[model samples]
Target chain A: MLQQLSAQELPKVEQEMTDFITQYTTQEDLKKSMLYSIEAGGKRIRPLIVLATVQAFQKTLNAPVYQTAGALEMIHTYSLIHDDLPAMDDDDLRRGKPTNHKVFGEALAILAGDGLLTGAFQLISETTLEPTENVLLIQLLAKAAGIGGMVAGQAGDMAAEHQQVSLGELKAIHRGKTGALLTYAFVAGGILAQQPAYVLTLLEKLGGHIGLAFQIRDDLLDVVGTTEALGKQVGQDEKSAKSTYPALLSVAGAKDALEQELAQAQATIEQLTKAAGFQPQVFQELLALFTL
Target chain B: MLQQLSAQELPKVEQEMTDFITQYTTQEDLKKSMLYSIEAGGKRIRPLIVLATVQAFQKTLNAPVYQTAGALEMIHTYSLIHDDLPAMDDDDLRRGKPTNHKVFGEALAILAGDGLLTGAFQLISETTLEPTENVLLIQLLAKAAGIGGMVAGQAGDMAAEHQQVSLGELKAIHRGKTGALLTYAFVAGGILAQQPAYVLTLLEKLGGHIGLAFQIRDDLLDVVGTTEALGKQVGQDEKSAKSTYPALLSVAGAKDALEQELAQAQATIEQLTKAAGFQPQVFQELLALFTL
Candidate 1:
């Protein structure tokens, strides 16, 4: 089911993101780096989750919200660009190609990342979302992306280099680095739909749980999967002494945690599914992406 | 006058920026990088320009625009961080200290730069300004920082690297890269005051011309100023084979161009100052910053 939906729906998500990225970035070098990082090709999962989550909430996607979803993908792309920089992960390889810095050189890569990151806000602010809602969404995105969220996570990740870390510490890092933005995505969708604050809070928690599980699954896969299968250098986490769930937990234990977290995430959405005006298929589809 | 004003006002600008930066970043490594770049320090000229521009416009010095002004300095700081990366100019020193990547390592440095850039948006979005004005301020800020402004100019600079560039091409790059944001500062004050579009437009033009002269002066200083005076490594541009106005035009020629541009910029503001609601002294004070 996951494969089937990704095959059908993921392509549309990629197209939408490509269209959005191309709009603000037209410089050849910038386009080269943006396409290099963005088109290097992943599952386009974040944006799909956004689209699916919005659909599940029974709101038709409007232009402003659609643009916000695209901006989320750009933010995701920018993170990848920096994560793969030589000063950071320093991996020459990403998604089976030379990393952004490798292809574009370091200065352009840094600027490309900077451009992508700043460009995301330009995309969001320019969206025609209602002023108050737009302001709220901007705040949510800023909080998720700034020191309180992604930056904090990155700081923690950097600090963990060559240092021992507990499972809880690792979870905290992933939760900020990866989960904060994901949580913001769902909360953004909920806010856009004018859902009640209670619903938005639940979605934020659910998204957070899923984002944590996603990172753990990624960690586990890195230990077991080939570099080609994972789309980048695998097992580098151990090389870099970077902490991961599988590094802290036994593989069996990590898998068990993922299962528990996944169940909780599903339960949150299940309640919504049974509620009036919910779209169960979207939630079901999102869960299926990870279960496989 | 310059030294006295700079001494009194510069520390406040530096302290405000430091406070804003500290709130978002505390990872020791990230802080090391952020501090390495920010603490390396300049005259706090950009933020001072912002505040002085506001003061010139008759706004109280303690107005909320001060926060917005500080945010602009963060953007400036981030640009320097990226520009000094191994990929771009590859400088190890900025303002006489190790560059961000040099002191903190590349990864943390990269993230620190990212943190500052993203934090700027977060800062502005969370400001206590009203939504209507906030949206407009963000639009102006983003344009200045993003593709049509700073980023675009950076791209032009990169493209022209090691190549022969015309005086016109150089001016365009400087205008976009440096001038846009500086212009945004002047226009931003007018914006916050709800100044008419015509007034804002005049300030914008004034900023553009002054910006060109500022860059020209900078290029001239590269040829003449000591490292002690500039607080950065001297002659780095010539080493990089990057073209500058002084390199493209003789020192005397560049100086001549600066005088012409400065005069034209002052003339435009002088015209605006004569209007009933417009204040000539405000613009005269702003222009006087460059004259000495």
Candidate 2:
């Protein structure tokens, strides 16, 4: 089932993204760089969430929502590209391949990232999604990426680098940076389906909790997972003096928090699945991905 | 009359922009940095063009055009903030003040730039403009800023840095980077006023010619103007090995090209003025600003 879903659904998402990127890139080098960052191997978790949420709510994958999913992934990929720049995180590897800045040079990499970032907005504004929903998506995505969200999280991350941060401060940081995008993914999917505003708000809170849990798990993996397993450098957080759940909380304490967040997220979605033929299988599988 | 325009119109524009920036900033340091970049000053040429174009067509500033003028200035300011970054142009000075990166450090400068860019879109989408006009403005602004336009020009600028670029190549670069915004300014003004499509197209073309002429004149000024007059480091283009009109075409050749572009632009507005009661003096004064 995992293989089938990954092969079919994931490629559709990838192709949609490729098509969008092609619209903006003409230069062979720029196209190459954009592809390098975008096609670098990683599970398309964010896109999957979008597809799953839309699927869970209704049968049809609305065309505009599909574009939003692709655009969100582009924003995610752009962030990764910039994060690996020499001036930023300075990582030479991502998904076991040369990082964007490493492959494309710092200048092109910067432009590629900017291209992807603005391109997200371009995709959003150009979509034929219902105007009200379109407006809502733009507002939600802007807040996610702007102040009090992902970009702000990045600012805080950069500012707090090497500083002694409390557990609370670390959670706030993670919530802003990582959680912001995850929250946006869910809210955007919900908004596109014309889900109730209350339900959308609940999903945002749920996604935020899961996002925090997801990052903590990664931090734990970085501390313990082998380079081969993680597909990149391990213990990078330790090297950079960045605070993480593993660093701030005991391993068991971090695990407890993760489990608690998983329960909360599951609980929030439980009522929404009360209808006929509602399969909890996908929900269970998603929870397991982070829980494991 | 020029002093009155500067004293009255320019200050009002400055205050409006200052108010916009003040909302997103609370940190004294960040405020100082943002204000330094914003207030360090330019001719407010783009916003002025937006206002002048609207007045020429509608005889008064409608709500949509008024808000859009501010938004255009925001977009223009965002480009400057990003352009002056260490990784981009590496300029430490702009408009007689420290560039954003110089004052805020590179990371905050990047965030500031992102904030400004995203904020421009937010301002436009949420405007009290007519819904149809709001939609058109969003579309126009996005196209101007995205892949084929302003940012594309920046990409070309980066690509051509340190290379032997021809006059045609330089014109293409400036057209995308500089001309795109100027074109958008005039077109946006025209759209907000519900001007006919033919008039809008003419304004776009006219704006492009002026944009190219503006760039050529900038090259001329860089070589001859005082730092006090230019309000930034002059002759830095030579230091950076950038190809300018004068560098590629000789001062005399560049001068001839500027005159030709000016004539073409004047011809466009002349037709517009003949068909409608559009004020030609607005653009006439602007032509004098650059030419005289």
Candidate 3:
């Protein structure tokens, strides 16, 4: 069901994202580099998460929601570009294409990433949301994506490379690096829909569970999934000696953990829908998409 | 007079910047890396420009104004951190100390820069400005600091390395790279003070002139100033074979161009003050600080 929704909405998200990026498309090489990354297609999961969550509230998609979705994708793309830099992950390919630095050189790649990150804020600020809501959304994004959030997570991950990290330490790193932005998508949808405080809390809880589950699944895929399927190198954790869920927990144990998280997420959504006196069928479908 | 005002407000700007950054100060190495760059202070020129511009409009310093100033400084610091990365300029020294990448490694240095940039928007969004004004400020900062602004400028500069560039191209690069944010400082001050559109235009024109003059002076200093006095490597442009005003125009001609920019900036301030029916003494003092 969520796949169908994603398929329906993916074109719209891509169009909106292209439109937003075109605003900066001058004749410069910098603009070309920036557009190159955005045009490189992904599953568009982040924007879909945003749109699906908004739909779960029975709210029709609006400009603010679409703009937020586009901004989130830009942020995600920027992170990928920076992560693929020579000083970082050093990947030569991403999403079956030459990485940003491979196409635009290291300096321009870095600048393109910088431009996208800063441009995200500009997109949100220009949205037609109520001022108070706009501020809240911006605050949410900055906290999730900024210093104490994803950036810090990336820093921790880098520092822990080739080192033995405990499960607790690994969880902390994943929470910041992978979990923050995912959770922000749900929370942002709730904010846009004007969900009650209780619902917002439930959405955050659901996001946490789903985020952990998503990371665990990713770890499993890196170990088992093909580079063809994954669209990039696999078993990188083993190669780099980076810690992973399957490393800390056995494969079976990791699978067990993933199931537990999915269950928790489902329970939270159930409780939230019950309290709100409506079934969020779209959210339930989204959870299904996460299942193997 | 400008120096006196900067001295008086410098500590306050430092204090506010420290306070804003402190919010992300965890025991994590990421936080330490971020702070390392923030604490290795420069002359705090950007924030002072913001404060002085506000004073030009006869406005008292307030929380929003100060926060914006601090945020501007953070953005400036972030740019310095990235520019000094090994993948970029490969500088090991900044502000008379080891550069961020030197102390924290390339990965952490990149993350720290990302943190500062994203945190800057968070700082501004959390300010107490009216929603309209806050959005406008965010838009201005994003435009001046994002693509088609500083990032584009940096890209052009990097691409021009070891190559010939026309005077027009040089000015275009400096306009985006150096002039955008400097001009944004004045325009931001005007927005915060509720100045009219005409005054805002004058501020932007003033910013463009000063920004160009500032870059020319920087190039001149590279030719004449010692590394000890400059607090960084000297004669880098010549070493890297990057074009500069001093390269395109002779040293004497560069000095003449700088003088012309100063004169144009001064004239704009005079016209602005005369039209606005205010003395704009603070602006005059700021112009003096740039005159050398």
Best by DockQ: 3
TM-score of 3: 0.95
Model 1 lDDT, residue A81, Cα: 82
Docking band of candidate 1: medium
| Residue-wise C-alpha lDDT for candidate 2, range A230-268, written one tens digit per residue | 767788888888888878887778788888888888887
TM-score for every candidate vs. truth?
0.92, 0.92, 0.95
DockQ of each model vs. true complex = 0.59, 0.45, 0.67
- Please provide, for model 1 over A35-76, each residue's C-alpha lDDT reduced to its tens digit, 9 standing for 90 to 100: 678777776677667666677777876666667777788888
Docking class of 3: medium
Better of 1 and 3 by DockQ: 3
Better of 2 and 3 by TM-score: 3
**Candidate No. with top lDDT:** 3
Per-residue C-alpha lDDT of model 2 across residues B1-292, encoded as one tens digit per residue: 3434456665666666677667654234445556667776787888888877877774666555556877788778878887877778777777667788877787677666666666666667766765556656776787787666777778788888789987778888898789989999889878866788999989999898889889989998887678887666689778778899878878888888889989998899888885466877777877787782
> What does candidate 1's lDDT look like per residue over B212-239, in tens digits?
8788888888887898976666787788
Q: How much lDDT does candidate 2 score?
A: 0.76
Shift of residue B183 alpha carbon in model 2, Å: 0.9
Docking quality (DockQ) of candidate 3: 0.67
Candidate rank order under DockQ: 3, 1, 2
